[model samples]
Structures are given as C-alpha cells and as structure tokens.
Target: MHIPDGFLDAKTWITTTAAGAGAVAYSLRQAKLALEPKRVPLIALVGAFVFAAQMINFPIAGATSGHFLGGTMVSILFGPWIGALVMTAVLLVQAVVYQDGGITALGANVLCTGFIGCFVGYGSYMLGMKLFRGKGRAIVAWMSAWLSIVAASAGVAVLLAASGTFNLATALTAMVGWHMLIGIGEGMITMLVTGYLMERNAVMTGGGFKNERLSRNRA
Candidate 1:
C-alpha cells in the first residue's frame, strides 16, 4: 500500500515522516552492527526480489493495490534491521524512478510498509517460534506473514484516517479487508522462501540469523 501524494495531510505526513526517519536511523546503526560483510550480496539479491514483487500489484478496493511484502521472509533470513533497509530501498526506488508512490508520502509509506512491516513481521515470527517451541515452523512463518500484512495495512489505515482521507472505521475496513486476501499470498511466499533458505543453509543461517535470535532472546 504505497500512499500517493496529497492523500495525507501536512500534519499527518510530517508526524509520520519524523517517526519513520527515526526508525530508519536506528535501523542503520543496528544493521551495521548485526550484519555480516559476507551477507551483503544476499541483501542485494533479496532487495531486488522485493522490489520486483512489489511491482506486480493486483487491484484492491478500487483505490489501491495489493502485493507480496517480503519483509517477514527477509527478516527471518537476515533479521529486522536489514529487512527494514531492504524495504526502504525498494520504496525509494519505486518513488523516485517509477513514480509508483509519492515523494511527500515516502516517510509515511515507509513507516507503515517498511518499518512496521519488518518489526511486526519479525516479532511475530519470533514469538510464534517461541510459543510453538520451535515446532510447526512452516505454520508459524505463514501466520507471521499474514499477521504482518494485516498490521501494516492497519498502520496505513490509521494514517489515512488521521489525514482525513477516510474515517477510521471505513479506512480500516477497506484496507484491512482487501489486505487479508492479499496476505494469503504473502504468507505462502514467506513460509516457502524461509523454509528453503534455512534448508539450503543460505544467507544468514548460522552467523547473522543465530546472533540476531540470541540478541533478541537476551533482550
């Protein structure tokens, strides 16, 4: 859900911009510390994949479009900080080069789809893994991905409501409703991709990902 220009009021956009900027700044620091130099290529590959996935959107509510958000899967493979960076990069390219999303609303879009998506998705995945005692991994991944999409869509709805673009209830119903269906694809993709990556011992498997989990648990 890439919010377009003029959709959000100045106050709403400015507030979201500040919050989103702060999140990204923190993410950069955390990612630098957590990320391995060797995984840079993997990050680039995932970022490209996410950008391509977002490019193919299906119509939703006659107002917006829905697509697979790779945040959950990426976070599982690399961790939240790097996942956020990947999403931010994709959003920036789409906004500047393709004009797919508005520049003014970039911060808002990032807050909802990048920051919110990454953290919520990551958190949910971790929690699910914990709750299930590390069993039913595929199911956990699917549920986490689904929840992440719903949470991100809800964030977008709240921003729209604050902007007076639509009332809170209406915005929530419309955005979340359409997103629930889209989330199915999001869930399946996240489950299969994460499973494959882990099985193949790809990317952050033993290094960054394990460290990320350890740090998170200690926290």
Candidate 2:
C-alpha cells in the first residue's frame, strides 16, 4: 500500500516521518546485534525479490490493484527486525528509483507497510505457533500474511481519516474491504513460497533447517 504524494497532510506526514526514521534506526541496531554473516546475503536477495514482487499489481474489485507484500515471508525466513529492514529497503528503492511511492509520503508508507506489516505478521505467526505447538506452521504463515495486509490497510485507513481525506468509518471500511481480497492472494503466495523453501522434516520437528545449522555451528 504505497501512499502517493499529497495524500497526507503536513502534520501527519512529518510526525510519521520522524517515527518511521526512529523505528528503522532501532530495527537496524537490533538487526546488527542478531544478524549472522550468512544471512546478510540472503537478506539482500530477499529484499530484491520483494522489490520485484511488489512491481506487479493484480487488479482487484473496485478497479483497485493489489500486489504481494513480502513482510511475512521475510519475517518468517529471517526475523522481524531484518524483515522490517528489508521492507524499508524495498520501499526506499521503489520510492527513489521507480517513483512508485511519493518521497514526502515515504515515512507513512514505511510505517504502514514496512514496520506494521512485518511486526504484526511476525507476532501473529509466533502466537499461532505457540497456540498450535508448532503443528501448523504453513497455516500460521498464511494467516499471518493475510492479517498483516489487513492490519496495514487499517493503519492506512486511520491515517487517511486523520488527514481528512475521508471519514474514519468510511475509510476503514473501504480500505479493509478491498484489502481482504488482497490478503487472500497474499496468504496463498506466502504459504506456497514458505512451504517450498522450508524443509518438511525441520518443519515437522518445530525448527527450521537453517536455524538447526546455525545452532550446530555455534556449538
């Protein structure tokens, strides 16, 4: 959900810009502390993939288009901090090189799509795993991905309402309604990609192969 220029008022954009910058800075620090050397290249690759994935927007109902938001996939494969970083990178590139999103509105987009999407999706996945005792990771991933989009849309709706672009009730309903369909696509793609990339045996064992390898290396 890229918010174009002029969508947000000065007050909203400025506040969100500062908050987004702060969040990204904090996430970078956390990523640096927890990041593994091997995962660095992987993060870069996934960031590129996310950038590419977001380029193609499929037409949805009401003449609106929706694209894949790779936050959940990245968070699941890596961690929330790195996932947020990756999403920030994707947003930056899209804003700068592609001009897909507005520069002034960059902070808002980052806050909604990068920060909120990653954390909510990651948190939901974690909660789902805990509740299921890790028995339905794919399902959890799907649901998390879907919910992340919906949550981000809700955030955007709130911002739109705050900006006086639309009333809160109307904005929330319209944004969430369109995004629910978008979330289905998001969930399916996340589930398929995560399933293909993750090892079945490791999934069944409630650990990832990459994590197991990392643990063994540490030992």
Give me the candidate number with maximum TM-score: 2
Question: Over 4 Å off in model 2, which ranges?
Answer: 200-219
Residues 45-134, candidate 2, lDDT per residue (tens digit)? Answer: 878888888888988887888999999888888888888989998889889988988898899999999988999998998789779976
Clashes of 2: 0
Query: Each prediction's TM-score against the native?
Result: 0.88, 0.91
Among all windows of 10 consecutive residues in model 1, the one with the lowest summed lDDT is 199-208
Best by lDDT: 2
Q: Tell me the whole-model lDDT of each prediction, alpha carbons only.
A: 0.85, 0.87
Q: Candidate 2, residue 59: CA error in Å?
A: 2.4
What TM value does model 1 have? 0.88
User: How well is each residue in 1-219 modelled by candidate 1, as lDDT tens digits?
Assistant: 789999999998888889889999999998988777788898899889888877777765567667888888888888889889898898889999999879889999888889888889999988888798678999999998998999999999999999987799999998889889889889988998888877532443344677756754322
Each prediction's RMSD over C-alphas, in Å, is 4.0, 3.5
